[model samples]
Every structure is written in structure tokens, then in C-alpha cells.
Target: MMFVIFISFTLSSITIINGVHFRGGMITWEPVSSVTNASPNITLLIHQRYAWSRSHIPCTQTNIFNRDLIGDYSFNPIVCLSSSTQCNSADYNSQRISSDVYCTDINLILGISSSSRSQSLSLRNNTKLVLAFKGNDSWLSLTYGSPAGEGWSLPVFIDLTLRPGIGINHSPTSTMPLRINIPIGILTSIEIPMSDNNVNDVIKCRWAKSAGTINGLSVDECAGACHSYTLPSTVQLRTFTKNRCQLNVTLPYVGYYIVALQIEDFSSNSSTIALSSVPLQFVLYGFDSYNTRTTCMTPPRITNMSPFPTSNGGNISVTVNGQYYGVIVAQTGCVNDTETYIANFITKSPSAMKTSSFPYAQNNTSQYSMELQWTPTIDQLGSTLTFCAIAIDVNDYSSDPFCVNFIVGPEITTTTDTTSTVTVTTTVTTSTLMIMTTSTTSTVVATTTATTSISTTETTTITTSQVVTAITSALSSDDGRILALGLGLGLPLILLISLLA
Candidate 1:
């Protein structure tokens, strides 16, 4: 009995130390400035994003908005772990960048939490380096793991080499949710949202590796959870495209599978070395009850509401120091209402952007909404920032990624021009007779005038014009006699004389 008790105590201690909290994470870097003249020396911003068990790393909405540090053991700084010359020295090996990851979001009910941190470092140009965050173990009991549990290792390859024409290189980014769920026995399509600043560069995706080096970095890309997906013999991938980062497959078994992939960018299709390599790790869950007898439940769809004019992938323009508001609405098509409902929202946004709490109530059935508010600062001017989101249901199924690109500052604008024209024609006539002449003489005069007006708002114009004429005539004695006879014959002569008087 004594020996058994000792063994039990030892097992409990081991479990506590391992903790099994890691979920998924990635690391990426970008140049601080677009200029490449600083060839030998350039500053880069390194960003890290990770998800963990909320039970292990607790966070609050307040902490997320305030960007407060997540108080946990994982807050330790990430260091260099590559065996290359850049990391061989004592100083380089010990080079610690604070992993001050702030709580980005928390879903206690789902037992998940996310955090992100970014730091800037000035390093030599045309150099290759690898940075990592290591942990004792990954999430508890992944579908494809040993009884002892697989360790958690996330390493990112940083290349500071400049492209031939594209001054500096920017790594590709993803907005895929950390977790996703699909119905069992049904084939589903998944497309990861990815983008790059260097539009000319070609991006590719591949499963993360456990052995060998990538881009000449001497380290395993993914530690233990490498090629961690275990598909049944009958199941085969229907379509897989590296350039688009898309896949179509069916998961027959009901279990959790890790999707560890590397997103790399190249100058062209034939380029051998990648400009930079970024890791995107997440989990895919298979469940049995996503479909019912009357109808087949599907993942929620993000509506193209106000501010978001286009459907899935679109772009919106904003200005610095101007407040921008956006609404994201999602709807599920499940006829059986009781089994599923929108639970939360997962987002990948720029720093300082704030998001409302999840599962906002709406009048429409099966509809959920969340609000995004942001005010771009002067520093972010002229930069195109990407924001991505996914609406998740209670069953862990998520909507297709809805990402919008925000073009910041005054680079893009809308201008309206209006023009109005007016013209007026006025004619004035005056007649005069001289008593000295025997014959009657008459003279007439006419005058003309013109005017123009112009008004502008940004750019506008208006115009105006006017004109006048004259005539003269002479009459003999016979004509005068005829006129007198006609006057005598006319009965209206008395009325005409009264008007003259």
C-alpha cells in the first residue's frame, strides 16, 4: 500500500509540471520601414500569437482592451534556438525578447484563450535566424500523440534579405481560427486566409515538418506535433493547393487533429529560397452530430453588412485619427434550432483595435453580431492593415474566414463636382419724333447685357448673359391722311385717347 501511494503521488506531480496547456501559435516579422538603404542594419517588428487553455492562463476582457500582460509562466521571453552563425554566440543564444503577450481574447466556456505580443529589433541585413517558444508538453491527449505526450515547440524563420525589386520583404499572414469543427463522414473544404505586402511574391503552404531544416535553418520546424493529422485508410485528400492554401478532405473519425503548416513567400515560382517562413498551427475537430434528419447543419456565414460591403475577402478605406465602426453579422442554416447557436468570435486584428463581446443578440433567428471599433493613428498612416474574423458555434464549427483590408490615411478619397449655368436675354426699345420736319420721323433704340457666376466645393463652376435693339422710320402727308381716316373709322379711338390722357 505504501509503494502504491508513493507511485500515485509521483504521477500527480509529473502531470502538474507538464500542465498540457499549449494549443496553437505562430511567429512572423516585418520591416519597420519601407526603406532598404539601411542594408547592413534594419529594424524589424517580430510578432507572436498563441492560444492556450483558458483554465491554465486566465484572462479578462478588460485585460484584452487594456493590452495588459497575461500573468502566467508562458510570459517568459522567447530566445534564439537555431544552430546557425546568427545564434551561435553566447549573446545571440541568450538574446531574450520579452514575450509580453497580452490577452487578446478569452472564452472560459470554451476553455480557450488567445494572446499576442510584438517587439522590435535592429539586426544585420541579409541574415537568417530562428526564434522559438518551447514548452514541456502540448494540449492534453491530442488524437495523434504518444502516451507520454508530445512536446510543444514553435519556431519561426526570419530572413532579412531584400528582394530584387521589392525593397524589403514582409512575411505572409493568416487569420485562420485556432480551432475548427467539421461533421463526420462529410467532405468539407477549408481555405486559410493569407496575404502578403509584397504583391509580386508568390506564397506557398505545406505541412510543418518534425525533422530536417527549412530554408537552411538548423532546427525542426514543428517539434512533436508534426504532420500530426491521422486520416483513415479509406479517406484521401480530394484537393490540396499550396499557392492558395486550400484543402478538401473528409474526417470520418471523431477526434481532434492538429494542423501544423508553414506559409512561405518566394520571389517567383522557381525561387529556391523563401524570403521568410511563418508557421500557422491550429486544431481541427470531427464530430458526429453536425447533421440531423430533417436538415444538414452547416457552418455560419458572415454577412456583408454596413462598413463591410463585400462578402468574404474585401477592402475598406479609412483615415488617420478618424473613428471607424464596423458590424460583423453571421447566420447559421441549421433547421434544428436547439443543437447549435453562435457562441463566440475569433479575430486577428491590428494592435489597438477593439472588439465587442461575442454573441450579441439580434432580432433575426440564428443570427449573431459583433462590433469592431478602431481609430488609426498617424503612425499607421499609408499602411494597409488586415483584419480577419470567424464566428464560432457551440459545436465548435466556425464560419469561413471574413477578412477586410483597411487602407489607412488620405491616400484614397471620394470627391464630388457640381456645375450650374443660367442665361437671360432682355430687349429695350425707345422711339422719338422731330416737330421741325414736315414728314413724321420715328427713332427706336435697343440695349443688351451679359453676366456670369461661378461657385466651387473642391471643384465647381456657373455662368450668365443679356442683349438689346433699335429702329427708325419716316412717313408722308398721304400716309398721315390714311392714318386719320383709319382712326375715325375705329370705335376704339376714344379708349386709346383716354389711355393717352
Candidate 2:
């Protein structure tokens, strides 16, 4: 009896130390270089992003800005589980990419720290493999549910076999906040935006399985969080078609539900094999506003303003090696001012992107804003980078994710021409014609014509050359004006000018 009690105590201690830190995370990869005859090997850049409890990881703003690494946690390398033997080599199998995760951001209010890291690997062409990151048992306890002692795992499938028409395969990307709060007893729909470089491929989403084999790789996708919540009889859990993953749910009780989903890309709707499988997991907290007397409390919304020219899941273009600046604005809908205020703005951005300090007030109203600044390097040319953000109120109610794609390339300029013809018949009278043209880029061209009308028709041609000159002059005068204006008025006006320019 003494021996059994001692063994049990030691096992319990190990569980407490190793099981409670992981919240959620995802794994994605992109081709580092194009496949060519000279270089038969395909190089891929693998990205891993995870969130953990701040109490365990201990991350701060300084750590995030400095790109510090969380060195305490044990390394859990992502390994290959595919049946193919080519990708199962020692170098490609379970090599530890990094000692620890890089601290990218931290939320003190929620006590969650976000980490992201990337590593490069090379593999031969036509290699099909499935990679997964599996962890030991124990997830953070839920508010209204029992402790989840089951382990967690994330897997992504990679297919190197070129498509029939398309050249290479690129995996789909997705983003969301670590946690979201929804009102109980009400139907709500959440849309998870999915973007893929292979625009022709069909993207779909489904609930993750606790144990399954994807493309001959057997593993547990999501352990304790697999189908953890029950939805209404009439509501479907998700609707995935046309690069969209929408979850229509209505929680009956006030508690936390873990949503685990895998996004996969197929050649077509009828294709049986998936080109890639990316995992996305997050938490949804249900709260009751009626019980707390919060009569009118609604989630915040991203405003459709100047910088944000398009709505969620829209595309914004940026130039290579050019500075890009923008702002995200959100507003709450609580009538009773004391009910809630904007608490935080959680974001998932590229490693080099920088954001302003969060929880900033916007003129005492319930509106809040966060500034984003990034300069795409020359190496990032022709790449589509994604940035996603969400706003959380003091009551923990979160808005829908607002994600945008930044296409990097040369600046795209649009020009519109306006031509007008004026015919005046005057006998022995001289008339002066003044034509002014304005362009969308704020370029103005003025033309003056003095004509002597003696029963003759005069035709004057106004070409777009004048508009080009005006635009050139404006650009020359504002060569370094983006930097100056950005420093003075912050990034909002600068991004507006970037969009207009």
C-alpha cells in the first residue's frame, strides 16, 4: 500500500507540471523556393504558432518586441507520420527545429502569451507526407466542465506531387483569437476566413477527430476538445465551401467550449485526396447577460473606414520594400456605458509586422483602434501575407475576426480619363474655355483655351498626358512625405495616403 501511494503521488506531480500550459496552436508551411529542374529539392518554411498560459510561459511586452524565446518548456518537435518512406528520414522526421518558441505577443488581461517560430526544410519533389505536433496529456480546465486530461495534437498534410494543371501545392492559411465570448441562449455564427495561394483548389473544413488516419498517417487530431460541445438540432456545426469555414452555433448553457477544426485543400470538389490539412483550434466562452443585468451589450465591430477600404476577408496591396501602415478601428454596442468597454485587440500578423500598444481609448466612446506598421522586404515579393485581428470587450465578448491579405508587388496605379466637348456658336465673338480635370489620386490638371469664333468649329483634344504630369509632380513633391506624415499624424493618415497614392 505504501509503494502504490508513493507512485501515485509522483505521477500526479508530473501531471500538474506538464499538463496545464497549452491553450491552442496551429502549423502551416510555404514553399521557400520555386521548383526548378536545376533544384529538384523543394524547400519549405514551416511556421508554428501556439498560445500558452502566461503564468507558465511568463511572457511580456518587452519579450515580444525583442523577439525573445520561451526557453523553459520542453521541446516538442513536429514529426512526420505519413506512410511514405522518403520523408521519414532522420533529418525530415523528428528533428528539433528550435529550442523554444519565440514570444511574439502577450495579453496580460487574459493571461495568455502567443509564440510563433519558423524553420526551413528541404525535401525531394513528389513527396507526400503528414506532419504532426503531439503533446502529453492535460489541457487547461474549462469553466463549467471537468478537467481535460487528454493529450492534444496538431497535424498538417503536405503533398509535393504537382497537380494536373497547377504547378506546386500551397497550403491554406487561417487565423482567429485564442478565445471568444458569446451570449448564451442566442444563435451566433462565426466565420473562419481561409486563404490559399492555389486559388483553384477547393477548401473545406470539418471537426477534428480524436483518433484517425489522414492519408495513411494515424494520429489523434484533437484529444479532449474533440466535439466537446453540443449544438442545436437544427444548426449545423460548420459550412465549408468556396474557401470559407463558417460555424453556426447556439450554446444553451454558460460555459466554455473548445472548437477543433481541420482545414483541407483539394484539387476539386470530387477529389478524394487532400493536398494539405491545417488545424485550427480556439475556445468559445458562453456568458449570460440577462443574469448580470447587461440589457444591451453586443460584440465590437471593425469599422469600414479609410484604411480599411474593404470588409473582412478582403485584399490590400502593398509594394515590395515599401512601408505599409494601417489602423484597425472597432466599436462596442452597449447602451449602458458602464456595462462594458473595449478591452483588447488580439492580432495574428507576420513576424515583422509591428502593432501599437493595445487597449487604447478612442475619444471616451466605446470605439478603440490599433495601429499596424510593416515594410515588406524585397525577399517577400509576390507573397500574400495575412493579418487577422479581433476586438474584445471588458465583459469578454469578442467581435468577429477581421482578416486581410496584403499582396506584395510594385505599386498599382489606376487612372480615369474624363473628356468633355463644348461647342459654342457666336458671330464675331471670342470665347475662352477653361477645362479642369480631377483624378482619384488627387491629381489636378487645368487647361485654358482661347478661341476666336467666326462661324468655325474648333476641336481640342485633352489627353491623359496632362494627368500623368500632374501625378508626377505630386509624387515628386511627396517623395518622403509618407515618413513625415506618418511620424506626425500616426499611421492612419499615412495608410490612407498609401491607398490613394
Candidate 3:
């Protein structure tokens, strides 16, 4: 086997090289703090930190780079297209090494964003840099810094004698190599794109409908026992499955009792989990009766909506209103990404005026919106707001919802006044969403936006004489029979009795 030894220097560094160790044609590092690791064939310390003009981030760069390590040692490592900056602020055990070959067997280890690995060294965009490290005869080691606060540690110089390279050489031993397992729906540390495993790969999830064979009382008798059905194996996280996902089972009886459903996912040890499908959601009623259509509309073209309101942190329902630009929606993301709301609301009122509520509700074809109102019973000030919408395709399958930005508005105040005031001011942000009404039969799309401000005031007062008159009128109106018959008039009574006869 042609052995290839690779060394990686994460950042520009200056390490005191104590000595070097070579065995079986393998060269390693040993740190004694006695010898300084020099850029090979040159006199400069292997690592040196430079200021992006001494302070600012976004990396420091130089138009001309001097690779000659023999001189001043002050070559602001030239920026290059393939440097480490491609990484988001994060903690990575990645590296860049000098093109030289003295201790080729050992690679330098630089940083790992314990939090946002890419955040550190977020230096100037497209800035060039070089990887440098420290070494010696006894062990191989290096230092690293994290942008997301695990900060810098007292140079974590690994012991090379332990097995592999420089200052500290720890052998890769044990069943798992620092394995970390995160639960399917747990709140995880915010991760950058490059450092995380696909959330789907980490979990297996599926939704199920209620299935029972018994009808009426018989199905009620079979309540505890439910037959299981699996979704198409391909149905996955962030992926929608709209196949006729019918839950087939034996029905003993059928009645007006409500059918219930609960969603589940696979756990670490292959266990089942009953997730919070709050109120045990009802996806489709009469689920057992295949091909059941329950008052479908133009699929609720949500014209516009405000973010869901809340009283506590991260506990708001996701709400948003907007016109149907060339899209259809199914649900909105609420509290957690999973706190979804079915976009298609079944209204008791006839489809608003002209549009039909078929295949999908098609009210005002272009723009429409609703205000998500809530009065938090608890902590109103600490609440956060989010607005997200899940669009559905013509195939009836839902799409990944996109979230909109939300600004928190102050609570509405009610004040008492004895006089009328015209300048009552309340700030309502006008949304970018606007729908244009045309005299023609077809719907028109409006993209223009305009800003307008408004203010208002109100007054209240009461008097005893008015209250007494109101009471008398209320009493008279309540006596409907006498009022209709004209209590004290002969002609009116005769006419009423004749009409009644």
C-alpha cells in the first residue's frame, strides 16, 4: 500500500518546535516548548496571526503573496479561491497545509466551530489564508478558535507519542468515534449547512389515519384495537405524500361518533412515538368511506394573513395572509415547524359571492388575507412572532412551506375620554400584498405597494333619563303579542283578529 501522509494547518500559527520523530518512513511531531516550529526552509514561525487591518473580520488579504519562508516571515498569506472561508461560521477539524515536505506525515488541525463553525474567521469574503501549526519531537499538537463562543482554549496540543503525530497523539480507539445522536424533533443547536446530517436521514416519520371495520356500536367496541397501515416507504421528512393513503380495516359498525387519528415516528431503538397531533387532528372526515367528498372549496386561496399572535416565547401559531399569486397552500407552520395549520378552512358561508369552492376554494383569485388574533393569557411581552405557509400542488400533495418575516406590534391600548377626538393613532403595517379589482370578469394581479397612516379617538358618557326611556322601550318591544294587536285600540284589534282568523 502506497501510504499517503497528510497534514492540515487550520489557521496561521506560530509553534515552538521541540524536535521531530520518524519511524517506518513515517515522520511525526513532538513538542517540548524548547524548539520553535519554523516554516520549513525558512526562518519564520510556522504560524502568525494577522489583523484584517488589525481588527475587522471578513479575512485579511494581500494582492501579492511571498512563499519564500527564508525572509521577513511577514507574508500576509495570500487569499485564494479554495481557502477555508467557504465554510460557514462553524467548528471544523478541516485543514490547509504548506506545500513543503519535511514532516509530511503529520497534518495540522485548526478550528471547530463548537457553535457556528463558519462564524469564526469569517474574514473578508474571498480572502486568502494559509494553514500553519506547531510541532516538536515528543508530540504533535495545535490550537483552534470557535466563532460561536466555545472560544479559544489553552492550545489543545495533542500528545503525538500516544499514537499518531505532534504534541498529543491520541489513538482512534473504541466502538464509536465520538458519536452524537439527536432526537427526531428535539430543539438542536443551530447548525450550518455543511456540518449537519440531513434531518431526514436522522429520522423516519409518517402520518396515519384511523381505520376500523366495525360499524356503529361494534366499531365503538373495537376502539382500543387499531389495525396499522404504512405510507409509501418513500414518504419522508420535508417530503409530502398524497397518495390515496387509506387506512384499511374491518368495520363492525358505523355511527355519528367522531373518528380520531394520531401520527407516529420511529425512535432510536426502533420504538414508536405518538407525537403531538394536538386535538388528535382530523385530516379527512368519513375516512373509512372511500371517495368521500366533504364540501371542498376553491381550496382556500389565502389572500393575506398576519402572523399568529401569542403570549409566551415560541408559542405563537404561525399565521400569514396573502393573495394566491400562482400558488396553492395547505398548511402554515406554527409554534414548532410541526405546529402546522390546515390552510384549507371550511367556511359555513357560501363561497364569497362569485368564486366556487371546488377542487380548491377560488374566492378572490388574486389577493386576500386575515389577521391572526390572540390575547396571550400569560406573558405577552416575551412572545415572538413567525409567519409561515405551506403550499400545495395541483396533485393535492403539500409543499414545504415558506416563512415570512414578522414584526411584533405593541398591544392595543384602550383609553377612556369624556370628549370626541379625531386624532387617535394606531400603527398597522401595510403588507406588500395588494389585490386589484377590475371591472372585467377575470381576476387581475397587483404588485404595486403604497403606504398610508391613520389615527382615531373615542368618547363615552351616560344619563339617567335616557336609561329610563331605553328601559320602557325595551319592555314594550318584549311584549310582541300586545304590540302586534294594538293593546288599547278597537279597530286595530278587530283587524288583527280578522287577519289571524
Candidate 4:
């Protein structure tokens, strides 16, 4: 498989705003250049898996001041598909931005409607870039940010990033890269993290409880369907894929969940190599299986999210701020068992973030929590504008869900769209991972201390025959006997502490 690149000049960063026009990332970023010497790369850096590749088609560039979007500096425009139902045959040409919002991928106009699609564009400027996106068309618009969510407008943690499972240029063609637009409350922590595990890798997940009633729903404009996965319950969608290729299904609904991952042989039995094979790629810092001894895909880390109380008051525009983190390989889950970990957080959102996801090392322990501050509109604070915070990990519900309990406020009046800033004084934390992990949602934020405390683990001692044999064999030697005598139940405990920490 092969693909080509149409370089529009590298950018400092990538952001998707207004409606997938490509502003930067879910969170805002100024154009950055610390990494690439070139201008901005229009590839999405949300996840390295979705990062820029040499083969992807390059979208054009526009000055932050250019709003007309006139002229033919791009490839032939195409229709932006409205919905799967609207995947019409007509090749309607459309424009990306005009005067409302700052844009990126908009350089290449698409076919149909303007949507909140999740598309990535690699831009130049490595770091100092301030990326922002919103529907500024109407006064008091709707907005989301890097630490993306309904009211999450936070600065993304710079160091939380890690290498991706697949290279951005790995996609052979445009059709090959699975680009998707996340829905409201559906935070994308990882992208296309499909593992090439062999047969019988034994994928298993822990459950807080079983879902009594499972209802399926559909997103009117999306290609996938949503599931009303009633929770406090958990299960592995792919404990063991019946087929060898890959299990690529979309659950278009909201709730908690995580990748119950593994690899297997032809018999669908546990394989020795597991995820070590070449074709297999794991999320870097996510809640993935990076442990030495893998058990049923590492004990099913994280779970579905708890329902969030929401308000659509006046659709008033607001800005949110927060931070992010990631957990990598060579690291441990937030807790020893994924089930118990997720069970604590599941009460917040059926789809909450967890500590045990892929790409686990880097972000999981970084400075991801920041004070969440906001001022609601006079009309909203007392009415529609309600704010809350939840500290969620890569796996939405792998740990206890934190909240600042939301309260509606009256809509506040602003003098100009540029100055009046509403603040939500709260805290937020996010983590990333490695390998192919399927996690839940980003609910609230907790104190970094609370989160870090959870990272501490317990020590267990286990004695083996090797120890006794060494003891007996060494007894004959004075030094060996001394060493053997010193070795007791405490030895394993000490070793356990070192390993867990």
C-alpha cells in the first residue's frame, strides 16, 4: 500500500475548531516549531497515530486574518458528507472558512456540511502557537478545547505526548486512515490503536456489575451506531476476536469502557508472543498491557462512564481551561486490578478515563491537573450555565471519578466577544497511553495529590521452590548460609515494593 503527500508548508501545530476546519487540536495551541524545523504540519497531532505522514494529502494554508476564503489556492473542493445517509453521489464543491473562525484543514475545501468532525492537520511553529476553535459565527458560541469536553477549555500538557503505534504516513491512501469526528462528551485520548495480537491471547475485562439492559442508538449524521450500555457494568468487546484480522466496530453511544486487549494463535488460544509481534502496536502511555506477565489482556483496565448532568442554556459561548497527562509502558495501572480501579470511577460517567490505557508512561504521571476556573453569564449562572469537574484518566473509569457538582447560573452579559471571560474555578487531569486501547470518557478533575496517591501500590510476598533450594544449597557455605538466613518472607515483599513503585 502507498500514499502521496501534498505539502502545504508545515505548520507549528494542528487544531480542529468551529466545525473541523482545522484550527489546531482539541485543545488550543499556538503555532509550535520545537519539533519540526519546517512551518506547520497540517496532520493531527492529537495522537501520533493520527499525526502527520509523508503520504497524506496536504491541505493549504490561510493567514489568521484571511477570512474570505476566496481564490483557488487549493485542490478541487469536495462536498462535506452530512451524514451516512447524506453520502450522496454528487461531488458538490464547498469552502471551509469564510469569516467566522480561524481554520486549518480548511485550506482544502470539502464537499458538504460544516460539522464538529475530528480531523487533524499538522502545522509548523513547534510550540508557542495559541490554537483556538469555536463557532464564533453567532454571538456567545459553542466551544471545546485541547482537553476536549462540553466545558473543557484547558491548556494541554506538553510532555504528555508520546510516539504513536502507527506512523502518520503509514496510511497507504486517504481512505485507509480512519478519520472520525468525536461526539459531545466523547473525548479522543487514543486513535486507531489496533493491536496485531496473535490467536488466543485471552482478552478479558473486569466488571463492577453486568449491564441489565443494553440499548442501541444511532448518531443521525455518523457512520456508526451508539449503544446505551447501562453501566456500573463492564465487559470486553473483544476478549478474543473470533476473526483473525481485527475487530473494528464502533459503539456510537456514551459510557465507560477500556481496551480488554491481547493476541492469540490460530486456535484462539493464548499465544506466547502476545503483542510482541511486528504487526501489533500498542498505545504508548495508555492503559494497555505492558506488564511482564500478561493475564487476560492485563485484567481489563477502566470501565464505561457515568451520566453527566448537562445544560444547553442559550447556547452561549464559553471558554474552558485544563491540563493533560499519560501513562506509558514500564508503568503500572492506577490500581492492581483494572476492575476495582474502574469501579470507583464508573459512578461519574459510564464512559470515564482510566489510568491503565496505552501510551501509559509519559502522561499518566505528569502535571495534568490545573485549576478549572470559569464565570458563567448572568442569565446562565443562575439558569443554564452549570459547571463541574471530574479527574478522569485515559481509561474513563479506571479510577474513582471526581466531581465539582455542577450548578446552573444566569447567562452573563458581555460587552464584546473578545474580552468578557467566564471562569470555572476547578481542577482537571488527563492521561495518555500506548498500544491499542479502547477507553471511556473524560469526566471531572481531582487534586493531583489525590491522583498521585492512587498511583502508589501495595506489596505482596511470594516464596518459590527456588528460594528454598538456594537456602538448602547455600547452607553448606558460611556466607551463603548467612545470605539464605537473611532471605525470608520479607525478601519478596521488598522486591514487590520496588517493582510496584
Task: For candidate 3, give the lDDT of residue 93.
Answer: 21
Clash pairs, candidate 2, are none
Model 1 poorest 10 in a row by lDDT? 3-12
Tens-digit per-residue lDDT, 41-154, candidate 3: 111112111101011111111101111121112222212222244322211223232312111001111111000000012122111122222222211111111111111110
lDDT of 4 at 499: 100
The sequence of per-residue lDDT tens digits that candidate 4 reaches over residues 271-389 is: 43221111111111123222323232222222211232223111223322111122111222434433322111111100111222112222444213222223332222222121112
Score candidate 3 by lDDT.
0.21
In TM-score terms, which candidate is top? Answer: 2
Cα RMSD, each candidate: 16.7, 17.9, 32.5, 32.8
Clashes of 4: 179
- What global local distance difference test value does model 2 have? 0.63
**Positional deviation of residue 346's Cα in model 1 after best superposition, in angstroms:** 2.9
From the highest TM-score down, the ranking of the candidates is 2, 1, 4, 3
Q: Could you tell me how far off, in angstroms, the CA of residue 129 lies in candidate 4 after the best superposition? A: 36
Backbone clashes (count) for model 3: 85
Q: Give candidate 2's total backbone clashes.
A: 0
TM-score of each: 0.69, 0.69, 0.19, 0.20
Q: Model 2, which residues run further than 4 Å from truth?
A: 1-17, 36-39, 71-74, 89-91, 94-96, 144-149, 228-235, 304-326, 334-340, 352-358, 372-383, 406-501
Cα RMSD for predicted model 2? 17.9
> Candidate 1 has what TM-score?
0.69
